[model samples]
Target: MQQQTLVNFQNFIIATRDSGYKSTASALAELVDNSIEAGATKVEILINKVQEQGVEQYEVLIIDNGKAMSEDELNLALQFGGSSRFNSRNQLGRYGMGLPNSSLSQCRRVEVVTWKKKGEFLSNYLDVDEVIDKSLTRLPKPKKSTNCVFSIQSKSGTIVLWKKCDRLSFKYLKSLIKHVQFELGRVFRYSIWRGVEIRICGETIRPFDPLFIGEGVNLKGGLPYGEELHYQVKIPNNEKKTSVVKVRFVELPVQEWAKLPNEEKRKSQITKCAGATILRANREIDYGWFFMGDKRKENYDDWWRCEVSFEPELDEVFGVTHTKQEIKETEFMSSILVPDIEQTARALNNRVRLKFIDLKRIQPQVFSKQQLERNDMYLPPVKKNDGLVKKNNGSLKIKGLEYEIVTKELKRDVFFDVEEVDNCIVLTVNTAHIFYEKIFKALHSRRINNIAD
Candidate 1:
C-alpha cells in the first residue's frame, strides 16, 4: 500500500473528544466492556502519574485474568473489525471494533501484553501519534518487550498498558483518575456484581442496582420470570432467519406502592409494563427505545421489570448510526418489528393500568371471572361516606340504616336482580329454601299488624 498523507493529529483528537466521549474516563469504559466480555474472572486497573523533562504524563494500566490470545489472536485482537466470533450463540461481541477503535480514539499509544498457556509473553503497541505524524498507512513492528511496563506471569491471561497519554488533558491527573474510576464502575457494574471482581486503585467497583434495597417498596412475591422468543423474517439477501427477542416480567410487592415517590412511581409503572431493552447480541444496546418516551428519565425503580434483547440481523433496520446514539426505522422494520414491539408495549401499558386500578381501590365486579373466583381475593369498593361506614362480612356498608343494610345484602350476592328507581334502592332476592318462605310469612304477619294500626 502507498504511504498515506500526514494527518492533523490535534484536530482529530479534538473532534473525537468533542463528539464520542466528553472525557478520557468515558472512553475507557469501552475497553472495560471488552475485558468483561473476554470471560475475565478478575480485572485490575491502575492509573499512575508520570513526570518527564518537567512535563506531566499519565498512564492507564489494565490487567485481566481471562483467556489469553495466541500469536495470531493477539494480532487479530488489535485490528479493527477482526472478530473471532462467527457463530457463537451467546457471544456478547459482534462488531469487533470495540477494542482498538475505542483505545485509539482515546489515547496517544495503545500497548497490549498477553501470556498464553505454554508460550512466552507477547506484546504489541500502536503509536497512533507516530503513524499519523509520519503518514504511514501500516504501523511498524512494536518495540521489544524489554521496556514494557505492564507484564503478566500467569500461564494464561493479558494486561494492557496505555502510555504517552497526552490525549487525556484533565486539569489535574486526580480528576481524570476519578472520572475513569466512575465510568468503569458504571459500565462493568453488572459483571462485577456477578462475582467477576474488578478493582481500581485497590478499591473494588460495585454495580449500582437501581432497585433500592430495604426500601419497603420492593416486590416481595417472587422473582420475575423471563423467556426468549424468536420469529422468522426475510432480509435484504432474501434469506430466511430467526430473530431473537427476550421477554421478562416481575410482580412488585404491594407495600412498595405507598412508600415509593410519585416521580419514581410513575417511572416504575412505565418500566414495569414496557422497560424495553435493546441489545445487539447479548450486550444491551440502550435502556429504552419506543417504550420509554423521549422526555422520560432513566429512574425506573425496582417495582418495574423490563425485557432486553436484540436481533443481530436487524441492526441495519434499526438505523444504527455510526455514533449509535439514535435508532432509525426502515420500512421493513417499521412493518414487522414495530407492530410486535408495540403490542408488547401495549401489554405493559395495560399492566400499568392494572396497577393503577389496584391503587385506586376499584370495585371487584369489573375483574375477570378467574380473578374474582379466588377465595382470598377481594376488590373492596369505594368506601361509602368516605369510609365512615364499617366493614361487615367482607362488605363495606353504612351503619344505623336498616333499609340500607337490606339493600347492601341484596347487592352483595351477584345473583340479586337490582335496579334503582329515583332516590330509593330497590332489589329482589328469590330462594327455594323453607327458611326464606318462613321469613316472608313473618313479614306478612307484621304487614297485617301495621295495617290494623
Candidate 2:
C-alpha cells in the first residue's frame, strides 16, 4: 500500500541532486562558507580515488577547524532547509540553500561528523540509497563517533564526507582539483586575504585576484581607471529609502603583456577575459558582459576589467537569485549603471587598441622575463598538486588583494575617501553623498514599467 505523502521523499532526493550548480567548486564553496562562518581558519578538501565493490570512483572529505555542532545541530545539518543559517542569510547570495543542497547536488550520500571536544563526537548522515529503498524515513539519530576517517587534531571542528560522487562535473581527479584551486582562490580571495588557509590534498591555495593589479602577478601595471563612480539607488517597496551601488574599472597593461608568448598569456588567464565582475559582500557572484549597452565585446576589450559592487540590501534591486550564480537584468537597475560603464569600457578598449598599435613601433628586446617565460611550455601541463603558478621553482609570493571598494556612511560632507586598509588601496565611497539625491530623484521622476509615449 502506497502511503499518501504530500511529496515523494525518494523522488525528491533524486531530483534535488541536479540542482544546477555551475561547477563542483561552487557547490563545495557552500560547505566552505559554513566553515568560515563557524570561524574556521583552515579548511582542507581531501579527495581519494578508490575502488568500492569493484567499481572505481572517488570520495571527498572536507575538514575544517571550525566550531563544532551539538547532536541537535548535527541532525539539523542533514535536513533540507532545516538550519536557521540558510533562512536568515546575512551575506548576499550565500548559504541560503546550504549544506545538504550543495552536498547532495554532487554526491549520493553525505555524512557529517562534528565535535565540541576531542573525546565526544556526534555523527549523522543522509543516504540517497537508504531513502529510495524506504529504509530511512526521517534523519537517522546522531551517534557517538570515535574514529572519523577525516579528523583534525584541533580541540573542535567539523567534517563533511561526500560518498558515491556520481554527479561531479570533473570526473578526473586532476581536472577537478585544478577547478577547485582556481575557484576557491578567486571566490574567497577576500577571506584568504584576511587569513584563511585552504588546502586541497595538502597544497595551500593562493588568492587569485582577477583585477591583476597586485605585485608578483605575471601580468602587472593595472591601475584604477579613474575616480571610482558612485551612485545611490532607491530601495524597492520603500520609495523614501535608498541604498548605494558603486562601480569601479581597471586598466590592464596591454602594451607590455601583448609581447608575451601566446602560451604564457593563456597560462596567466589574460588572453580573453573581458567583462564586469559583480561583487556582493566578498563573494564574486557573476562575471561576464554586464551593462555594456549594445556594444559588442572584442578581443581588445580583454585588457581592462570592471567591478560592480553593491550591498545585499540591493540584492532585490539587482535581481540576485538564491543560487548567486547569476544576476538578472532589471529595467530600473540598468538605466542607473549602463551609460558610465559602457562609456568607460569603450575608452579602455580604445586605449588597449592604441597601445598595441604603438608597441609595433618600438624595437623588440629580450626582457628579463623572456628566459623564464616558458619553464616547460612544451612539456605537457602540470595537473596535480598545482597552485595558481606551477613554475618559478614552485614559489609564488603574494601580499594581498590589490584593489577594493568599501562603502560607509560619513558625517562630514564628502563624495568619497581613499585610504590603505590591510595592504589594499581601499576606496571608501560615501553613500550619504548628496550626489545620490541628484541621481535618485531623477530616476524616480521617470518610471519605465508602463508602455506608450
Candidate 3:
C-alpha cells in the first residue's frame, strides 16, 4: 500500500492567498455575495484604521442580518471548501471556497462571528501567521463568546472581520470607501432597487443603474432603441434546465448631448457607456464589447448602449468565473447572441451617423440666430476698408478679408446663408430643403439656453 503524507497547511494557505482577485473591491464583493445568498435584507460594511507596533493598519468588517450559523457550522465555514451548500444550483454560491478564498486573498487573518438569538454568540477564526509558525495547525473550534467581533444588533446575524490587511489595494480608508460605494452601487443595483439596504460606513448605498434607464436616474432626453429582446437558451448538457436571457438597446440623445462641454460629458459618463453591460442574476458581472461579431468598436458606438442579463443557471454558458468580475464569452454564447446584436448595432450606428450629419448641417443656422440675439455682445474688431470686392461662385470675396470659410452640403434651393462676425464667416446650406423646418422649427419648439446645449 502506498503511504500518503499530510498536506502542508502553511504553504497551502499562503499560496492560496494570491488567488488572482482583480482588486480589493472584487474580493469584498465576494463576501457581499455570500450575504445576499443567505437572504440578508440589510448589510453593513465598516472600515477602521488602527496602530500596531508603531505601524498603521486597517480592519474591515462586513455584518449582515441573515440566518446565523451554529458552532458546528462556524467551524466548517472557516475551512476551505466546507460550505454546506457547495455546488447548489439555486443559490448564488456554487463552490464552497468563496468565504475563505476571498477573505485570505486580502488579509492575513479573518474571524467569523454568528448568533441565532440574544446571548448566544459563537466565534471562530483563521490566522495565517499562526499557521506559518506551526503554533496553530487547524482552525479554532467555535465556542460560546460573550464578546462578538462587532455587536450584533439583530436577533440573528453573522459578521465577518478582517485584520492584518496587508494586501488591500487602497491604503486610505476614504479612498476605499469611495471605490466600494461606486462598485457595490452598480454591482447590486437591482437588489438595491428591490428594497435591499446596503450601507457603507453608516451611509446607505443607492443603486447606480449603468444603463441609466431606471426612474430618477435616466438621461434628460435619452430614449430606448426599442422594446427589450428576449431569448430562451437551453443548457448545453442539462436537457431539463433552461434559462432566459434579456437584451436591451438604448440610443442616447446624440444631437442634444454631443455638444456638451468636455467637463459635463465626462461627468455624465457619455464615452464610458459605449459597451455592453453583462448582468448575471440581476447583478452586473462584467462589462465590455460582447456579441458584436466581426465589427470593431468605434467612436460613434459611444452614442448607443447595450445590456445583456441572464439567469445564474446559465453561468457555464456565459463562462462566469469564481471571482464573478468578468465573463469568458464561450463559443456557444457568441453564436447565439452575436448575430442579432451585430445587426442591431449596425442599424443604430447608421442612425447615429445620419443624425450627426443633420446636426452639422443645422449648426450654422443656429449660430446665425444666436448672433442676431447677442448682437450687442462683444465682437472682434475688423480692419478698416474690409469690403466685398466681388461675388465668386455664390461666395463673397472681399478686399483685405482675412476671414475663414466653413462649407456645408445644402439643398440646391437655397444657395447659402452667411453671418460674418469675429473675423469668421458662418455659412449655412439648405440641406434637403428642410433647413428651416429642422433647425428653426425645432429650435422654436424647445428652449435653447446656451451654445453648449
Candidate 4:
C-alpha cells in the first residue's frame, strides 16, 4: 500500500485554525502560558492598528523576557503538539499545541523569534497562505534573524508576531484592551499575585480576585466560610496516581455592598456572579456552577463564592479543554465533589438570607430606606429644608435615596413629624410625647428582648 499523507495539509491547517481558540483572549492566554512556563517574569502584549487595503486591522505582538529557545527547540515549538514539556504536571503547558495553535487561530501568519545568546536570534513561522498554496510544504528552517523584539537584551527573551489577523473579537483598541485586561486579570490572578507582571498596551494588568477577599481591591468580603475541602482525586492518565484538589467558599458583605451603585456592582462583577472559579495549577480554567448538583441559583447565592483548584494531573477530572475557557461535564467530577459543595452552597445561601433578615430586624426602618427608592427616586429633590437648625442630623442616603429616622423634641402636640430636607425625608418622633415614653420605647424594648429568644 502506497503511504499517503495522514491529513490534507491545506484543509487541516485551515480547519485547525478555525477549530481552536474560542476567544481572542483565550488564544493570547495560550501564548502567555508558554511564556510563564518559560519562567517569564515580565510580559507585554502590544496592539497595533494597521491599514490593510483601505481597511483597518489589528496585529498583536507578544514579548516575554523568558528563557529563549535554541534553533532545535524553536523548530519543535513551531510544530503542532510539539513541546519539550509535554504532559508537564507542574508547569502551565501540557499538550504543547499552545504556541502554533494559539497563534494561527487569530491570524494567518505567525512568526516566532527567540534568542539566548546576544546577537544569535533563531526564528520560525507557520503561514496559512503558504500551506494552502503548497509552496511551503513545512516550517521553514529556523535561521539567524534580526532581533526585532528589543534592541538590548540581557541574556534571553522571546517574541511572537501575529499578521493578517482575522479572528479577533469585534471590539478593538480601548474595548479590546479592556476586555483582555479584565479576563487576564481574573484568569491569572494567582500568577499576578505572585509577582508576574503583565502589561497590555503599556497599561499594567491588576489581579481581580473574584472572592473580593484580597487586598488592593475596592471591595471586600467576609473570611472563608468553612475549612478548606481537600480531595485526592485520581489522575485520569495514571489511574494509580492521584492529585490534590482544594475547595473554599467566601461570603461577600451583602449588607455593606448591597447599596452600591448598579454600575459599580456590575463593574465589580458581583451581581449575578454566583459561581466557582476552577483553578488548575494556580491558573483559572473554568468559572461556573461546577460540582454543585441539583442546586438552583438564586439572588441570595450571589452573596457567596466558591473556588476549586486542582493540579494539572487531574485535568480530566475537571473536564478541562484545550481552550481552558470553560470546563466540560465529567462524571467523576460530579460524583466525587458535588455533594459536599452543593450542601455548603445551600448553607451559604441560607446564611446570606438570614443575615439580610437580621439586618432588617435590627433596622426596622430599613423598609423606609427601601421605599425611598422604590416609591420616590423619580421625585424632584427638595430645595426647601426642614424649618430647623441641622446639627448631627444623622441623615444619609441609600441607593441614592435620602432617608432619616430620629427622635426630636417637637413643640407641637403631634406624636411625630414628617419633614423633607434638602436630599432626604426626616421622620422625627417627638421625644417628649407619651408615644415615645410608653408605646415606642416599650415596643423597641420588647423587640430587643425577643432577639434572645
Candidate 5:
C-alpha cells in the first residue's frame, strides 16, 4: 500500500511538472541548477537535431562534473520528490523536481548516464508516453542499454541526455538557448565569475556580472544616495540566530549614463544600478522589478535597481514556489522586507520626482534663451511666463533627477533626514543647509577630484 501510494503521488507530480514554466529554457534551467547543487565546477550543454517519424526532433544533452550517483541513488533521483537534500542543510535543491520531472516535462524520453568515482557506468532511459498510457498496469524499470554513448570519462560525474523532445521547436530551441543563456548568466553569474567554467556547444559562457566587475569594469566611487541603513532581525525558525538586512541606494552618474544613445538607454535601463535582486545563500536569483505592481511608466524604467540578498532561512518566509522562478511574499518576509524596501523605494521616488521639477524649471528657458545669449555656454534659458523660472531663480538643475536644485537660496532641497524615534523612525527635511553646503562645497572644488583619486 505504501509503495502504491508513493507511485500515485509520483505520477501526480510528474503530470504537473509542465504547469508553470512557459518554455524549454526555464525547464532546462532546473537541470543546470541540480548540477550546480551537486558541486559541479564545470557544466556543458549540447543541442542536436534528428529526423524521426517525418518530424524533426531535437535532443538536449547536458554533461556535468558533479558527484555521480550509485544505483540506488540514481533510482531515487528519478523518483519525484525523492530528494536526498530534503532534510540536509544549505543545499540548492530541496524540492527535488529538478531532475526527472524537469526533463520529462520537456521531452518524451530522458536518458541519464552516470559513472561513480572509480566505478562502472550505468545508464537508464524513461519513456513518459508509456508511463502515461492508461492501459498499462504498472510502469516498469527504465530500459538499460549496453551502448552507453552518453558516457563521461570523469572519475565521478553525471550526464543527462534528453531525447524525443516533443516540446521543442526549431524557433523555440533558438529562443530557449538565448533566454536560458541570459537567465543562467544572470542567476548564476556569481559561480562563473568565481572561477567555475560553464560551456554551451563548446563555447565558454562569459559571466554577466551586472555589478560590472568582470571584463575590466570596476566600481570605484561611493554610491550616489549614500547612507547605508542596516538592521538586525531574528531568523524565524532559528531563534538563537539572527539575520541582517541592509539597504543602500545608488544612482549612476549622469555623464556616464548620457554617453549612451537613446536606444542604449532603453535597453540597459532595466538591468541597471540594482533593483529587486533576491539572493539565497549569498547567490543572486531574481533582479530588478521595483515593485511596480503592473503600473507602467517611462520614468520608472530609468537606470535604477536594488540588490536584495538574504540567507536561505528566508526561503519559506518568501514563499518559494515550485518553479523557483519567483518569490511570493509571505507575511513574515513582507513585514520586514516591505517596510524596509518601501523606505528605499520612497527615496528613489523622491529622486525621480525631483528630476521632473528640474526639467520643468530649466529645460525650455535654458535650451532656447540662456544658451543662445551666453554664446552656447551649455546652459539654456526658460520662457518668461513659466513658474519654473521663479522656482529655481538662479540655480542649476541636476541631470536625471529633478528633486535637487543648486540654488543660492536655503529652502528648496528635498533630501530626507530620518531620525530614530521610539518604536519607529521620523523623517524630516526642513531647509537643511548644512548637508547641502557640505555636498556642494565637496563637489565644487578641485580638492574633491584629488580625494577621489
Candidate 6:
C-alpha cells in the first residue's frame, strides 16, 4: 500500500495571502466582485477604527443585498476553491479563490454572516492564529449568530467582516476611505451607471467615467476623436464563439487646457492620461501603453485618450489575472488590435501637435496687448555707445558668418526681448515677468546667505 499525505492548511493560508495583490483597493474589489456576481443591487462598506494594546487598528465590513447562501453553501464558500459556480463564465467571478484569497490577504480573521429571510441567520469564520496553533483545522460550521453586522431587512443578504486588518495599505481611516471611493468609482462606473448602488460609510459613491462620455464626471470640453471601432476577437480555446471588442477614442480640449496651472493639470489627470485604458467586462483592469506595437509614447500623446473594452469570455486572450488589477498583454492581444491602435494613435498625435502650434501663434498677439498696458518708462540705448557693443572674436561664429554681439538691460515686463541693429544682435531680459518675480527675485534677494552666518 502506498502512503498518502495531505497539504498543511495553515502553511497554505499564509502562502496564499502573499499572492501579489498590489493594494488594499484591489483586494476590496475582489469582495465587491462577489457581491455583484450574486445579483446585488446595494452594497455598503464600513470601516471601524479601535485601539488595541495601545495601537490603533481597523476592521472592515461589507454588506450586500444579494441572494444569500445556505448553510451548506456557506460552509463550502469558506473553503478555498470551493465555489459551486467555479469556471462559470456568465458572471464576474470565475475562479473560486477570490473570496478567501482576497479577505485573508488583508486581514488575519474573516467572518461571513448571511440570512435568507427575517429572524434566521448563520455565520462562519476563519482565524489565522487558530489555524497556526493547530486549534482549528477547518472552517467553523455555520451556526446561529445574533451579532451579525447587517440587519435582516431584505429577503436575502450577506455580510463579510474582516477583523485585525494588519496588511491594509493606509494607516489612517480618512485616507483609506478616500482611496476606496476613488478606486471603486472608476472600477465599477459602468455597473453603477446601470443601477448598482454602492455606498461607503453612509455616503453614496458617484461613478467616474474614464472615457469622459458625459455620465456625471467627464473631461472638460471633451469630444469624440473618431468613430467607435469594433473588432471581432475569437475566444481562446473556443473558436465557435467570438467576442466583440469595442475601441473608442476621445480628445481633450488641449487648446483650452494647455495653459492651466501645474496643480490644476495634475488634478485633472491630463498629463497622466497618456495611454490606453483597458476594460475587461466593463471594469477597468489596467491603463498603460497597450497594443501600440513599436510606437513610442510622447508628451503630446497626453491630450488624447483611447479605451479598449471586451467581454469576460476573452479574459484569457487579454491575460486577466485572478487579482483583476493588471493584464499580461499576451501575444494574442497584440496580434488582433495593435495595427489599428498604432495607426490611430499616430494620427491623433499629429493633430494635437498642429493644434499646439496654432495656439502658440496666438500667444504673441495676446502678450503684445499686455506689453502696451505697462505705463513705466524705459530708457533707449544710446547711439554709438561702444561700451554696449563687443567685436566678434574668432570663437564667435554663426553659419560661417562672424558678427558683433551687443547686450543691453531693458526694463520691460517680458522675460526675453531680442533685436538686431547696426550689424549687431542685441539681447535684453525684462525684470517684470513672473520669471523675475519668482525665480530672479528669490535668487538675488538673499544677502549673501546672511554673510555666511
Residue-by-residue lDDT tens digits, candidate 2, 37-132: 889999999999889899998899999989999877787778876764653436533444678888988888999989888778889899999999
lDDT string for model 4 (269-347, tens) is 8887898998888888878877888999998888899999888777776677766666775887888788999999999
Question: What is the Cα-based TM-score of model 6?
Answer: 0.79
Top candidate (lDDT): 4
TM-score of 5: 0.69
Q: Among these predicted structures, which one has the highest TM-score?
A: 4
Model 3, which residues run further than 4 Å from truth? 1-7, 215-222, 364-453
Candidate 4 lands at a TM-score of 0.82
**Model 4 Cα RMSD, Å?**
4.7
Give the TM-score of each candidate. Answer: 0.58, 0.76, 0.78, 0.82, 0.69, 0.79
lDDT of each residue in 54-162, candidate 5, tens digit only = 8987888999888877776777777666677764437666676677777877787788887765446777666776666644344345444444565555667788888
Clash list (residue pairs), candidate 3: 411-430, 411-431
In model 5, the worst 10-residue window by lDDT is 397-406
Residue 452 lDDT in candidate 3: 45
The per-residue C-alpha lDDT of model 6 at residue 241 equals 78
- CA shift at 324, candidate 5, in angstroms? 1.6
| Model 4 global lDDT (CA atoms, 0 to 1) | 0.80
Each prediction's Cα lDDT score? 0.52, 0.75, 0.77, 0.80, 0.59, 0.77
Worst-scoring 10-residue span by lDDT in model 3 = 394-403
Better of 3 and 4 by TM-score: 4
RMSD of candidates 1 onward, in order: 14.2, 18.2, 9.5, 4.7, 13.5, 12.7
Candidates arranged by lDDT, highest first: 4, 6, 3, 2, 5, 1
